[model samples]
Target: MINQKSEVKVFPTNLMKQKETTTKLAIILPGAGYTSQGPLLHFSSGHYFKQEHDVLQVNYRFSEAELNPFDTDGFSANVLHTLEETLKETAYDQCFIVAKSIGTIALANLLKHPTFHNASAIWLTPLLHRDDVYQAMLQYENNSFCIIGDKDFCYREERFANLKSNPSLKTLLIPNGDHSLENKEDVLGSIDMLKNVIDGVIQFSN
Candidate 1:
């Protein structure tokens, strides 16, 4: 199912095998404000569903109250608490993640849990400067892929080349896309980039 709302959408999958069923969950952590309703996150969910994996798009809220630096801890704590609750009841065959921006920060914490070990990920528009974000990706380099636009504010000139050293990771750089991997002046170009993002996701995930 396509994720069209700012609510946790779970596309449940069931496969009967001698009266037993199994589920593979792909948790999506979208960027703050952008949400999973956006085209990139939405189409990515479709790809997982097509592969018979249950997609869990975790929708979170961010308010002006969380704007300050101190509140960053509070916000991350909230997101972490939600993740704990989300996983308390289910046991999945293969647990995967698709996180963007702030979601990647939360995911950095999530990766520490033993439950998420060996899990693969697709990190979009990450805050590469952050120690935690890049560290987590590096720790799980073999099981993860990252995509960022060259035009994004976080795109560091000095570190980008070094980041490419990890051949296990598949990193994509959209030419003129900003944080959203979009081209505002050229609508057609933006559309093509979106398609390219989807293709990259499919290739990495599959």
Candidate 2:
């Protein structure tokens, strides 16, 4: 079943049988300007849906003034509020998060929530520049996967190395890939990069 609304879209695998078996929910959080329909998130959510997981894609919109400091606590708060309210009544045995860019800030906040403490995450091009995002990644105790491009402005070698120290965390660095994990000089290479990231997601699912 599918439901499309202003703030979010829901794709349910088995609404009637959700309570009979363990329920798996996948939440896709997009970047500031990137919508859930973007390549990475669109495909990721489709994959989760194919696997019989209920998928929720958040379509958050913010004004220019509100986004001036996209990584601020206020911005994170608004995202968190929307998420918590939208999901307050949903029932699931497991939760999975796929977050990119500013969504990573939301992921940081979600990690602290009691309901999602054990949730696994796929962080794509996270804003490691933000102290909160970095600290959350540093202290996360559950299974999580992260992918970032070496060329992205948010990418920090020292910080990436530190995150790798966490045995439970899996990190993938795309050479010459930008914030979108695309190679500006080679479209074919960018496609390959996407394939590699999807492969990581598949492995993480297992």
Candidate 3:
């Protein structure tokens, strides 16, 4: 049975719900300029990984309230701080972070911190120039996957190819898809890909 909750926490500012057994937890961070609700209600598709893991979607402070800091660095710092705090409050055997677009950038920055050394991460259309961050994540105790659409504007083929050449990093490219995977209307396809990725994480985490 899939269970769902809304607005479960209120410190770092997030509105989230869970599906399936609450044993395994995955924190999802959406792109910039979007509230937590947007990705939770849209890309998550309700059944992406519900059969095997619980999902928690979070929003940045600026997205939750109107106290705009108006700086990307500050916003990223706030988001990373919130993630760290939230992880402290949650009880899960293993933690996985799924971030999209600008959110992926935040995750990358967070990866540089020693606090997230053991948490697995998946990046969707990550937009950052720091290849070192990705390399650092590969060297961490956790596994990391980078997913990008072939048609994605930010998809630097050469860079991604280079990343994939590294045996430690996993990369998946969706065919004929955009940054949002818009061309793939088949929700089943999305679900399949997500399942495979999650399963791989579970395998590696063990």
Candidate 4:
């Protein structure tokens, strides 16, 4: 985990990098109470696409265990702003975002922001509620994929159906898995689904 800190429009931004040789880049956002290192480990162990792509895991404003207090709204805004600045600096040919749980909602919020537009996204167990922000994300034009575990407490079949009702979104269900993917054996299935999504993204980019 490569830790670095910078200021983006007055907001302190912390980031971690997992470098690879490929042109593709993945901007990862962790779930609530999680750090970039957590996602970095998961991606490094499971995401074969990383072998051909660089993974940039970002630590949101209030998600850090130490040095910051939990403030959902403020952290969300910081995530959007940080992503906007990072995109400008990196100027990647094809940028893809992968967000888990709360991170997914944050990424969706970023999508709705005018300053952060036009990026493909993958949401893993997105913590979506009945809100205008969720509606706005459903209407966004970018290619999107939402992956949910069938056994996830926060996401049920009804919720999955509701999200899939959006013609623009694609959904993947991992059976008997939870929000954290605690069922270690089920990870292969999750990885397979992720691989398929990455393959689709590659085809779309080409």
Question: lDDT: which candidate is best?
Answer: 2
Stretches of candidate 4 off by over 4 Å are 1-24, 39-41, 44-54, 61-71, 85-88, 130-133, 184-206
lDDT for each residue of candidate 2 in 86-169, tens digit (9 for 90 to 100):
667777898889999988988998888888889998889999988989988988999999899999999999999999888889
Alpha carbon lDDT of each predicted model: 0.73, 0.81, 0.59, 0.60
lDDT of 4: 0.60
What does candidate 3 score on TM? 0.65
Which candidate wins on TM-score? 2
| Candidate 3 lDDT over residue span 1-206, tens digit each | 10132222333444243543355666777775544555323444244354455566766433423433334455456666666666566666666777777677667767667766566787766663556445544454457777777777877777777775556567777676566644567777766655554454445434
Model 4 lDDT per residue over 1-206, tens place: 11233333423334444453455667777776555556423553235243455666675544245424444455566777766666566545666677777787678677766654666777766775535335754686777777666667766566667776777677777666667644466667666655554454444334
For residue 98, model 1's alpha carbon misses the true position, in angstroms, by 0.5
lDDT of 1 at 118: 64
lDDT of 1 by residue, 1-206 (tens): 11222233332222212223456777888886778878998898887877777767777655555433324445455666666665667678787788988888877877776777667878899888888787777666557788888988877655666667776667788899889989889999999999999999988887
TM-score per prediction, in order, is 0.84, 0.86, 0.65, 0.67
**Which residue runs does candidate 3 get wrong by more than 4 Å?**
1-23, 33-54, 61-72, 85-88, 128-141, 184-206
Candidate 3, overall lDDT? 0.59
Worst 10 residues of 4 by lDDT: 1-10
Stronger candidate by TM-score (1 vs 3):
1
Comparison by TM-score, 2 against 3, better one: 2
